[model samples]
Target: MEIRHFRYFLAVAKHRNFSRAAAQLGIAPPTLTRQIQDMESDLGTRLFLRLQREVSLTDAGRALQAEAELTVRQFEAAQLNAQRAGRGETGHIELGYVASAVFSGVLQKQVSSFRLRYPDIGFTISENLMPVLPGLIEEGRLDVGYIRSPMHLPEALSTISLLVEGFALALPGSSWLCRLKEINAAHLQNEIFILPEQISGTLQVAAQGGYAPTLGPQPGGLVAVVALVSLGQGVAVVPESMVDHIKLPNVVYRRIQDCQPSSFLSLVYRRFEKAPAVARFIEHVKDFSERPTL
Candidate 1:
């Protein structure tokens, strides 16, 4: 009827001696006897042949033992599985990110540290940008994200400022901008800038500075942006880390000399949605944030 019954039944079945089973279980012999009797009564069968000094399983007792062993094993497995999730030992976290996030380092570093701290908590990463996230986060499809800041965050969600990524020009090594220790909007006054249809990295910074930047070529995503810059189509204003991935054969990265503005990025999480696994994963991330060793 219950897991305890199977445990008792197994102990009794193993010993084939009531007194010995009681001794092994650390329960009084009479208590053990009563429990076995109750189990037999509930099952509508006698589990053992009771002799003054000997016991042996009946046909029904062996049948019950096999099924009872499985039930006990299942309970134990379920219990351990739940504990694993609570301790961040097993389970998964779903995360979303926009491209410029790689440069921010905040989310990336936190994730690396969290993985080391809770290796059993598997990770599912998705590349979901800002424009389409209102439905994702609200519908509980996305657990957490690194997204553009200064937008209207969804209601019942939380955000924490993590990094400030500013615009830096990437140009051909022979381009004049590379001659300066730094470059800025003024430096590009007469130069063409390659822009992405999803020019998230530079657009956010440019908007805060003034007007949208005039475009020379339109690309999509960071890779496209880098490819355009490498082709000498036009210089691109991109996050610093984009260069890390797209080391061009003839391109140079220069800091914006007259930094009109910068873009802010933050880690966003659903508010008040508590799951044991999610909480543990975030704690690992928060601990990493406090001490950024990654």
Candidate 2:
């Protein structure tokens, strides 16, 4: 039966007077009577017994009334939630970040802006490399990953360039690289370089000077890299995000000149089947960025 039929029957049953119910519904008396008649006919039962302008609900009307009220309430609730989701209000976002974001503030700012706009959406963050993250995102275990560029994005994956931050030579406070106001590629040729194990682009860039320096690929994690450099184990090329953290007590950071390759950063998401909330969050980020202000 039509929803209006339920509304009409309930109003008439509640008022117990055809004229009063018709007026309350802002419908003509004859029209209200026809609607009630139609509902009773459709249900194959007498919903109301009319007598001298007074009405009383039949057995079926009472039974249907209880269920109809619940249906209407549930419908209203569903509509409210849909609206909230559309406005990017209620949902959850699983985000992944590589080591660079840990030092650079760009990722944090993007997330902060998104949270401010969509406060109801919870944030779940993961810090990992693309070799592992790509599979997780494709499997729906992750919503998005902040990964380094030069990725082999499959057809099942999509991405938007987030930032292209150049690598700087990060060193110990007393190291000689820190003393150079401007670092030339040749300066790094003889120093031990600490780069992430999964970063091919970083290795390629540092190789431009053809240093063939000692390979200090610290596979453990960012902390290990910093610790190694602080103790003068070797020099590594790190992104700016690492600087955002409290500087490693004895570590120094400086930009490199005549670098072979640039550092490219991107937000990676599974293509074609991303959750709706993920798209909404990305759009908010793009909008806020173009607003001409930080």
- Candidate with maximal TM-score: 1
lDDT of 1: 0.74
When summed lDDT is taken over every stretch of 10 residues in candidate 2, the lowest stretch is 197-206
Off by more than 4 A, model 2: 1-5, 19-51, 56-68, 82-89, 174-182, 197-201, 257-261, 289-294
Q: Write the per-residue lDDT of candidate 2 for residues 1-294, one digit (tens) a residue.
A: 777777788788889988899899999989999998888788899988778869887888889889988887777789898988876678898888887765666688888888887777898897876578878888888888877787687679877776667666668889877767788777777777776644554576557777566787665466677788888878777666666674787888777777745566777876674466888877765675456545
Q: Write the per-residue lDDT of candidate 1 for residues 239-285, one digit (tens) a residue.
A: 66566766768778877755644567767777775776677766665
Runs in model 1 deviating more than 4 A are 23-28, 42-44, 86-88, 103-108, 148-150, 172-182, 190-212, 215-218, 231-233, 292-294
lDDT of each: 0.74, 0.76
Provide the TM-score for each candidate, comma-separated.
Answer: 0.79, 0.76
